[model samples]
Target chain A: SQTIHQWPATLVQPVGSPLSLECTVEGTSNPNLYWYRQAAGRGLQLLFYSVGIGQISSEVPQNLSASRPQDRQFILSSKKLLLSDSGFYLCAWSDYQETQYFGPGTRLLVL
Target chain B: QQQVKQSPQSLIVQKGGISIINCAYENTAFDYFPWYQQFPGKGPALLIAIRPDVSEKKEGRFTISFNKSAKQFSLHIMDSQPGDSATYFCAASTGSGGSNYKLTFGKGTLLTVNP
Candidate 1:
């Protein structure tokens, strides 16, 4: 069985601060990873996705960026956070079948 | 051409009643359709999925009806329970090619099954 883990389940950051969220998957290798943000009571917005290490694709242009530093480790980072950046960030992994499994998620609140 | 539209932004149903959510796509190239269920403050989980080749697929109390000609698909929940009260999102993708399963998700429907 595979499991996904995310850190800082919840975070409160002040405006103009930096942001970093990590996601790691176990029991699988060479899996595709994705980053998405869900606004309050709204649909999910895809931010970035990676096929392999050092390869990342941006679905939407914004202040956030994603990186696949390791086969099973993915990180979402931002040099400076904006008020609009506050939302529920999610990390997902998929195999050949492309059925994505998501992690518990990180809720960031910018004040 | 890559857009998926869903209806009924919110729904309220009685326990043991039927719950239905509809989704339509404009891109005929889309071959894969999936539905996800998300609880408050959590990530969406894959609930059921159907391909264009199948007209309908059922799993336990959940069913996915795919209409190839209509470019539409729907999810049906039988004997809905309070536990089923959550946000449902419908998504569609063109193919399973490497790094191409970019799913376009619907706005999501908030289902509340009253006990």
Candidate 2:
């Protein structure tokens, strides 16, 4: 069975601070990884997706960026966080563009 | 442009009642439709999915009705329970090629099953 793990399940940061969220999947290789942000009472917004290592496609133009360092390791980072950047971030993986499996998610609050 | 649209921003149903959520899409190129259930503070989980080729698909107590020509689909929950209370999101995606791998999500519906 495949399992996805995310770190710092919850975080509180001040404005202009750096942000880093990690996502790793075990038991799968060369899987499609995606980064999504869900604002309160709003639909999910796709931030980034990667087909392979070093290849990242950004869906929205924002301060956040995503990188797939290893086959199953994806990271979402930001040089400086904004108040609008606060939301629940999710990491998902799909095997052939079929169903996507999401991680536990990281809740970030920028004060 | 929102590719997919879902109705009933919020729904309150008593236990043992039926819960229905409707979703519509404008893009004819979309071939895949999926419904996800999300609990508070948790990630959305794939509950059920249907393709354009199928008119309807049922899994356990959950069912997905797809109308190809109407470009609409819906989810039906039979004998709803309190555990079913959660936020439901409907999503659609095109399988063409390239960046089409991403799924466009709806605004989401908050379902509350009163016990």
Candidate 3:
């Protein structure tokens, strides 16, 4: 069985502060990883996705960036956070473009 | 034409009643349709999915009905329970070998099953 883990389940940060959210999947290798943000009452918007290490694709232009430092590790980062950046961030993994499995998620609030 | 339109932004149903959510897409290239269920403050979970080749697919109490001609699909929950109260999102994807492996999702429907 594969499990996805995300940390700082909840985060509160002031404006212009740096942001870093981590996601990792255990029991799977070379899986497709994705970063999504869900605003209140809105559908998820894909921010970034990676097919392999050091390969990241941005779905939409924004302040956030993603990196696949390791095969199973993905990180979402921002040099400076904006008030609009506050939302529930989700990390998902899929095997061969199949069904996606999401993590618990990280609730980020930029005040 | 990548939008997936969903209807009934919110729904309220009583226990044991049936819950239905509809979604329509404009992209004919989309071959995979999936429905996801999300609890408050949580990531959406894959509930049921259907392929364009199938008219309907049922899993336990959940079912996905796909209309290839209309470019529409829907999810039906039979004998809905209080636990079924959550946000439901309908999504479509082109699957592998096209554009990118990203899903285009609906705005989501909030389902409340009153006990």
Candidate 4:
């Protein structure tokens, strides 16, 4: 019964603009959260993951940053967006070997 | 080091045919293997998964064949349909790390099924 939500479903921003994408999970508590970016026809690249509040592990070092202020709330942010930052962003939650359930995803377009 | 490697950057198959995608991993610690399906504009969804302890596991038209000794796993889609056309990803992870375990994914394979 666990569900994940992400927004804005789609985004368009000019280069160098600040960005913020939010993800939240319902029907589950204390689940591991992850942020992934996937380019068109490409595999997912793990950006960040958190096991609990205030515990963020970054998988890739880039212009983006992640924060876990609450147990089920995760935010992906960037001070200045780059053309390369545009892609499909996904938020997920998992427990043990159970499959990770992904949200609808955010399609970011940086012009 | 990249722990997992997936082959066939892309594949095309006709309806009712079979689609096969392969993946290999170097880390022996990986016990859980999973296959994910992604549409053009959607996040990857968990299609099926197999644990190293099981040689094979099936769910509907999708199956996962795992080879523990070879450190390899594969996804087989029988009776392929156009709706199955999408990007497929193979991922491996170990719960041995407990709460810190994170999935390590392969580059991915793109599958296209034509009617």
Q: Which candidate is the best by TM-score?
A: 1
For residues A21-69, what per-residue lDDT tens digits would candidate 1 score against the true structure?
9999999989888999999999989999888999999999988888888
Model 2: residues with Cα > 4 Å off, grouped in runs: B96-100
TM-score list, all predictions: 0.98, 0.97, 0.97, 0.96
List model 4 lDDT by residue over B1-115, tens digit each: 4578998889999999999999999889887888888887888889998888899999999999998998899999999999999889999888765766678888888898989
- lDDT for each residue of candidate 2 in B7-94, tens digit (9 for 90 to 100): 9999999999999999999988888899999999999999999889999999999999999988899999999999999999999888
Native interface contact recovery, all models: 0.75, 0.66, 0.69, 0.78
TM-score of 3: 0.97
Instruction: Indicate the TM-score of model 1.
Output: 0.98
Give me the displacement of residue B15 in model 4, in angstroms. 1.0
Could you give candidate 3's fraction of true interface contacts?
0.69
Q: What shift in Å separates residue B61 of candidate 4 from its native position after superposition? A: 1.3
Error of 3 at A107 (Å): 0.3
Model 4 TM-score (2 dp): 0.96
Full ranking by DockQ = 1, 4, 2, 3
| lDDT for B33 (candidate 3) | 89
Q: What is the DockQ of candidate 2?
A: 0.66
Residue pairs clashing, model 1: none
Candidate 1 regions with alpha-carbon error over 4 angstroms: none
